[model samples]
Target: MTKPPKTAQTAGGETHQSAEDLGVDALTTNHGVPISDNQNSLKSGTRGPTLLEDFVLREKIFHFDHERIPERIVHARGSGAHGVFEATDDISDLSKAAVFTKGEKTEVFVRFSTVAGGAGSVDTPRDVRGFAVKFYTREGNWDLVGNNIPVFFIQDALKFPDLVHAVKMEADRGYPQAGSAHDTFWDWASLMPETTHMLMWAMSDRTLPRSFRTMEGFGVHTFKLVNAAGKASFVKFHWKPRLGLQSTIWDEALKLQAADNDYHRRDLFEAIDTGDYPQWDLGIQVFDEAFANAQPYDVLDATKLIPEDDVPVRLIGTLTLNRNVDNFFAETEQVAFLPSNIPPGIDFSNDPLLQGRLFSYLDTQNSRLGTTNFHQIPINAPRCPFGNFQRDGKMQTKVPKGRANYEPNSLADHGEDGGPRESPAIGFSTVNAATGTDESGDKLRVRSESFSDHYSQARLFYRSQTEAEQAHIASSFVFELSKVGLLEQVPGRMVSNLLNVDEDLAKRVAAGLNIPLPMKAPAAKEPIDMEPSDALSIHKNMKATLEGRAVGVLITDGTDADELAAIVEKVRKAKGKAVIVAPKVGGAKLSDGTQQKADGQLAGTPSQIFDAVGIILSEDGCAAMLKEGAAVEFVMNAFGHLKAIGANDAAQPLLDKAGVVPDDGVTGLDSKFVKAAAQRFYAREPSVRTLA
Candidate 1:
């Protein structure tokens, strides 16, 4: 700067040519007016308040103030990605939807969300996840609005609002945001017998999915598939992850919330950006009316599920997410999904909850978007051509040239312009099975008797779990019930309901809470002791591979550089990521006198965020880390969580300080360590912490 150098250092600290020298375009306002000074507001003096005449400041503030729109009522916190859904198997025999034609690729936008959180909520909450996908098909936009869990909390749509209100934060306190471990929720749940089945799933590890890529999705309602000949078959939709199902323990999930608020979102974004595209198989469980009637429970019941043991899932298609959204608010936020957005070949069942959602979603879009023209938004618009008689609503972007706005008009014969008319042959047609009333014949507001047995599946779920998983489920119930401070009886009432599901489970939860076991609650229908289904257990179904997992490498000054590189290479060879954590953000100098950059700082990034951990320390580094609490916690938490731990000889002191006992999962740095790190040593859990 003393001699006015050729390149000047910008505010970002990088030397660059001036805008004029670089021939860059000048900044302009929305109206295309040149903006001379954007750094400072127009003012009477240097320290004066912004002048009213400053149009730039006024415009910017006005737009900023109105930038945010209303968030979704339930699935408020979400992450989305652009993807392609490819038909791998021909399902035209089951349905005539073109998207099911073998080898056909359809553009899709998928959003993964937490059900009971605000837009600013953390990602690792124990809650139901909304898995909604909008397929831009040739016929129209087909939205598959579903959830990670197969069943819901209620049997009928009428109880939906009450369920949501109870789960949400209390109106007076407005506290306990993004959680359902309060008195109001437990009190309401204890009174509603239909919630028993879903509560079991919600309290289990299913609600604590490790990542969206490892979670299973369900349509949550019985639907129908109509063929070209108008023959209908009842179906259930399932999205099975390519990586297999996986979840974090309750303790790990709690710690993850503190380590990274955007854990899921960041994982999705980074995965897509790095070309590690996530994939899922679209599976369908198809059955006829006879099979549906033959089941122990009603197919029309929203609270029930067709066990995989009963009806095998047929793999029909694959969905791969390969791109992150360019603008999150423009694409992910403004996108609207409705259960009513079905293609011609697909139709709905008479499920009471499904019926209510068909009306609720359309009405919600109207109120939230403040216009019926939300269809005009690019994200929500259909890919195929669309036209209608309706026009001139708020935010209308299309200009229609026509004298006739209504259908069944003769304006075309008089040479006046007429809009497009509905197609009779190729357009949408409602399935005959969905058009009539049920055998009851009366339009009464009542739940079907077939939907009454809720505890049988709950028992099936509990008995299906591994011993460790069952203990975790019991502990989770005790933890959540303990948070219900307002009602001491609410915990007992919940335990009483649990008695109908499994007496042992009820006893375990009661013992954990230090409360006396209550008498069994009366069930509308006695629970049948259904054989335990292995498909319902996460541990039984987990893939014994390290692919798509992550590991954290703890390093310090003078650590072996060759060992660090070898560990990272091994992880990459296994299709996993190895992140480096050091004491300082600038990282440390290795034994080879080479500086290596750290992916994260030790204090900020905890071991909970990774599937496994490795500690490579020098003798001096070990001494230094002994006095650091975070270093001790890094090893302690990983060992206590039953995660595989890899360490060098020098790291023994730090491991000893953290009370890490030698186990199968705790291995010295070697080829065997990589394979061991791929799995959680559940046998070591009992030695580390006592479970319910």
Candidate 2:
């Protein structure tokens, strides 16, 4: 009989078994072969692309792909748009891809999605957003799949399955749709310290974007760019929004979820329909091996990021989403994007997380589309001519023309068209000279020593934010940890991990939870303090402009027509949108004896949906609105959310009744109102609410 494995206790007093205790009953493959190192995948060298012969990796990912049928396992709820990417700068020396040629335009499709949600989940959840772009270049297709945040939770692909399993709705009860504030997620996160850095981003306003157009996109892993000279350089991709970065506060976000379930999707479609096309600039941080080696952390680690201060991003192209899809199911639902689909000049790197993604995305498409010929779909097909002799599978749409299906056939000599052949001259080539990768190197599953530091960047990110932002982060942690009810150990375990990131953050959360702070969790490697970078804070980088903002104007019967017109004109002049809200959607009688139209009903269009709000009311009109519950809450919420509120003298009584204290954001319906509408009143936040 086999002896039972010995149990080990964690800092939180949780019992778990170690690999050394497994002895005879060890973890193994389906064939019963013991896995030597389950932490990392098989690589050719210390830092090299994953090897195909790594059957352990293929088996693990293959099973995960078919776990469900039809709907995607992750990023299930998504919104897509058709667009064009035009090269605005010359970077031919850095890359040979035609999509980057100056003055060149390529057709592109982009999809924005929420992670860890089902197809029917709400869009306003505090979750990571997927920003994936598919470019139909002359050289074929290139998919730049990324997220709104720069760093990830895990470093290696082998742990991806575990991370997803923990974060998803718990297996036993199946609750908490599209959210991570649960026991399973916190329990898993407490053990993995590498999730610290991304936790700061996840808890901040970055995940609660004002709209899809207001978020920044990032390629989370390091990639390689090859020039026409065959010289390769490391590169990272960034998509800077033209509208600038903006996010909804936690309270506003909750109210928005209750008001509208499809806020983001509707915003994207309306922006394109109204000819206010959303645009973003494509930027790249180019570097060489020398620069990568000098960094304190490994560039190949997915949990780490190279600060923009180290390598300033250079703008090269612009992408404008100009068209909405004709059919939602045909275009948006069926579109497939694979990270492995890269043009000639753009190539893969040895990043373990990225290497696993190349294989996982292809298999995912196969599972969701339920066919190998999914590329034949119109939305996924290439614009340029493409053909191959290999054919015949599930849902095969193309029919071969001749009997010369076999390659190296003499059919061309017999006056027959031999299908496409390999072209070494104009085809994509993988750099194989004295580069970093080598197929002949030793095969091992050990992780590199450089990939151990996990908390340094987390500290840098927390300290970079403004005081208000820091308070929000601490409050967010308290709210999320409080939801882990009855899992008493999980909350303290998480606070222990936070101690390594910031002592103040840990104390704030501990005090909020009403629990004693525990000692710091064990660290794999001691964290070092790095220079603060201003690029990390959304507050520090926000632009005080109304280029893509929306303002809500409240009007009543006998309201001043001149004041309403002035507000609309001023909002429009600033390139912002003005929406009129009234008691009835049909309209209200104005002072000019005209029945003015209202864009939305006051009860339906709460102040949470707009960036700023205006209140214009007559003496009798204010008395009537004071009796309505929705109207009172509307004004109160706007004030509590720190949004600008413009009111006429007659509306002062209503504001006083709703507890709207005088502040910089509250002004008379004059030039001061328009000027104040451009920014959020962060200074007023401390007075309106208490944070952890």
Candidate 3:
């Protein structure tokens, strides 16, 4: 098990304590003396000053003072939930991992995180998301730490610190918090050509995922799977969400960040709480060493990707997040995942980034855990039986009864059993297939020739996007590069890199930036004609139902209760959520004199936060709410975001004020209009205004 990276914070107004929740008598001093009081400081007298002789007081206070560890330079802000991964299909031919054996269910913990924000930062930022999972298998605990994006920025680990330094808050001015729109980032990216592939993904809608349930997870590096016979094969891991991929528009995301900072977390929690558990199918792209060597590019390159067309993903298992954490501090915040935690049959490749990760993980754990025995934390410990000769470190809880710690001792065969003997037939064994010898002193740093062509995959990614999605990518580049203050003609430099991807893309981005298009584009080893992969497009695959989605209905004084009840019943039957909003905070009277209070006032809740909007206002209320700025924005944003808007006859003027054309998305709906509002409006979006 690996300790959490620095930057886990106590949420909101909670205090952080380093000790486990085993009570006062359960906790002991560093010198093995039991502690009776952990809640209060020991004093000279009943209410007197704290005494220096009270080592218990000193230990508690001293630990509290240094409770916070350093945050990760990236992926600081995150949310976690407990879940179970169940094997739905058998894939014993691919590997011998016990967790994937037929008809097995294992406990798992997953953490979803945004890559570039503080722990308390808003959830809907434009950034790559982390999708890390830890599985407690029969053999041991295995961690599959990965990101939503299938590829990474650099091919090697040597450029990791440099990449993070550029993306983090600028050195001189610590402004632009939780963002990447700066001169330093573009400057570094424009110079390093390999970043182009991932930049295409980051600029696309994948970075702005609508919900954690809608995004996919990739291992991002090549790995190996060894069978019981010691035969090894190359593999890649994938987690495809059952709901498919979806993302919010940039304008909607910005507004949602202000309206509800916890949008994604709230959506996930409510979905599980309502028994609509989010699920993803575990997949593996299996290949042999001969096939890996036959590839045009190095399979070890982190910046490159193998097209799914070449090696299709085979689904083997499913993971469902069915439970929320009982305590955020003890479980979620303290849970740790490291790539080095691999069960038998699953092994590592020669990817440089992965090699560096093996060393970086344990070292970073020490900084966060503050002790060598951080694994003793229940969340990090394995559920299965585990024992070894090693013992007695800081925070040690176990006490072996005998002194026979050595395995080969003559006194071990007695009742006091010596350490367990190794079983080679069942134990993990490393594969040794290397032909090159280390004693020849042939070690030298060099980039493989197969990893040189970086622009082909970038081109493949761009060309794979739909026309509108490609336009969004170009617009996103324009928006981010426009914020670079010091770099004049930075757009040209970025577009120059894009020329290697596509001439039309370079021209469009250049036009958006008000610059001249390049004369010619660079060429790739394989021409920029890779077949488009449907998995890459968010707009191409959206959920057709409104389950786990929110709808806001605006009401006013003297509104019809029967009509409101009908709409609520229809939405509820579809597994959708509905919240009421009124012109005033305290709400208004209905036709039957039944005074119902609203969940939020019109000024506080905006229509942009919901998937659909309803205006069930009366004639007088419509005229009154139309005069308010928030009400106008509520209706306008809903239409501009291409959401379904159901209105009453009296609400026509509000729709008119919002400049909403009477289309399919704009309907005079009652119980009958529930069906159309559930599906996404891809056709209606083109008629709306493009913010960029």
Q: Please report the candidate that would top TM-score against the real structure.
A: 1
> What tens-digit string does per-residue lDDT give for candidate 3 at 467-504?
77887788898888888887875667888888888888
lDDT of 2 by residue, 1-692 (tens): 32334665779999876565755566778666657578899998999999999998998899787654587788999999999999999998999999999999999999999999998998899999999999999989999999999999999999999999988998988978789999999989988888999999999999899999999999998988888888888889999998888998999899999999999999999999999999999999998887887898998898898899989999999999999999887888898999999999988888989999999999999989989999999999999889777689897989888887888778898899877798888788887522454634688989888988889999999999999999999999999999997678999999998998999999999999999999999888999999899999998878788778899999899999998999899999989899999999887899999999999999999999999999999788899999998889889999999999999999998899889999999999887888888889999898889899
- Candidate 2: residue 160 Cα off by (Å): 1.3
Candidate 2: list runs displaced more than 4 Å: 1-69, 432-440
Clashing pairs in 1: none
lDDT of 2 at 567: 88
Candidate 2 residue 398 Cα shift, in angstroms, is 1.2
Residue by residue across 1-692, what tens digits does model 1's lDDT show?
11223466779999766445656665666666556679989998988877899999888889898798888889999999999999999878888888899999999999999999899999999999999999999999999999999999998888889999999998899968999999999999999988999999999999999999999999999999987777788899999999999999888988999999999999999899999999999999999888877778988988888889988999999999999999999899999999999987899888989989999999998887879999898999998988888989899999888677898888889988777888867777877554232454777867778888989999998899999889888988989999999688899999999999999999999999999999999889999988889989989988877788999999999999999999999888888899999999999999999998999999999999999999999999999999999999999999988899999999999999999999888998887788988888888888887788
lDDT of 2 at 420: 79
* Candidate 2 global CA lDDT score: 0.91
Instruction: Report backbone clashes per prediction.
Output: 0, 0, 2
